[model samples]
Target: MHRVIAKLAGLTLLMLSALPSRAEEARQFRLSVPAEVAESGLMDYLLPRFALKTSRRAELVGGGAADAVISADPQAGTAVMARAGTVYALRLTGENAAARRFADWLSSDVGQRTIAAFEPEQGAPFAAARQQQAGPAPALDGDPALGREVALRHCARCHRTHDDDRSSGIGSTPSFPALRALPDWADRFTAFYVLNPHPAFLRVEGISPPFDPTRPPAIIPVELTLEEAEALMAYAASVAPADLGAEIVHQ
Candidate 1:
């Protein structure tokens, strides 16, 4: 009777050890993006592709503009999330072990394949159509002049063109600091802005459009096309502050 009772207790301990705890089961994560990007009808196109690719290992939950869903459960592997613009941001979240596994998976061949599969059908392709509709192409003869012209035409309204002596004006200037930090920053910045000209950060900063509907109206219909954005980035790069090199160090 003693031997049988001891065996039964050992079995109970083994079963309990295999069971997951409550904390492990209730993990959650939140991700946010610009509302305009969500409303622009791109998230719908991107979400399913991301989910299908990731669902085998992770549970893809809520997704929309400004916020997304990802599970924190150890069993639910890592989740990847992104927000749009020339300077896009992406994040991954999960338990330590699962997150590490997901990171390895993302860096692997299978992960690359999954990312490659995400087709922004309505975003990039639509932008190309709009570009075609716009009349004769401006001669991009590897000249900063073309960049300046593009900038003056599209971006001058929101940003400063020339260098200002006043510190106050400089503080308010929305310059392309990133371009000046990188090698060939001019060409890369121009290309990026020309491809996507939307002021994603401006909206968040309450400088363009107030995202909250409850707040008093500020700006209306805050969005921009890739071409318009590209023009702005290119122009900013052309006239970026000389001290941009120092900013990169801090970054």
Candidate 2:
């Protein structure tokens, strides 16, 4: 009888302790941002549009307890406050789907116009492109030789482009042949500028480096047009993979 009563009491305490957590779960859909953004009325302007698009209400939490963070680019100067794009929070649970919807809406044409109108100078009016349907990946088409020319002009400073090309690029940079070797090489050209070697070596963004007037900068950012990017990808696809040397002899 005593054991049964003790078990009942413990269960009651457990249920009591869970109440606050359950309450928190009920009111979730919260986003986190810096105290400055929250206090400065940015959220006030953004949240209403957000609610309209997602058909959900979201509470903004200050001191960085948000599901998403809206902050200034660390590299951007005060004069031109470059928009660094949104950083959405990662939560694997299904409950956070509302956050995804909010993000999609922000990138949508309607959201772009609203954002542009909000800050005329910085936020240029955005017209969202039609969303592509999910299906088998489409084939990449471009002129490989033209791509090679673009690469030689822009990437050769750090990357070896061809077999006979004698000058090795930066120590860390892999040769074009080597990069093409990877199965995921296509991704390298998809958003090349935003990714690795480009981010670190090329396009450093914001203030341009002061250099000697006589000589060109050793490594300037490569800003490719749509045709150029496609060409580069085509050329990358054409290249033979680099031989990474003999397989490791495991003990």
The lDDT per prediction is 0.40, 0.53
Write model 1 residue lDDT over 89-129, tens digit each, in one string: 23354344333444454445555444434444333311111
The candidate maximizing TM-score is 2
By TM-score, how accurate is candidate 2? 0.41
Stretches > 4 Å off in candidate 1: 1-6, 14-97, 100-154, 164-184, 187-251
The lowest-lDDT stretch of 10 consecutive residues in candidate 2 is: 126-135
Local accuracy of candidate 2 as per-residue lDDT tens digits, 123-210: 2211111221111222356898898898899878788887778775776888888877755576554445433224333332232122
Q: Weakest 10 consecutive residues, lDDT, candidate 1? A: 125-134
List runs of model 2 lying over 4 Å from the truth. Answer: 1-139, 199-219
In candidate 2, the residue pairs with backbone N, CA or C atoms under 3 Å apart (3 or more residues apart, or in different chains) clash, namely: 31-66, 32-66, 32-67
Query: What lDDT is reached at residue 36 by model 1?
Result: 46
At residue 72, what lDDT does model 1 achieve?
Answer: 22
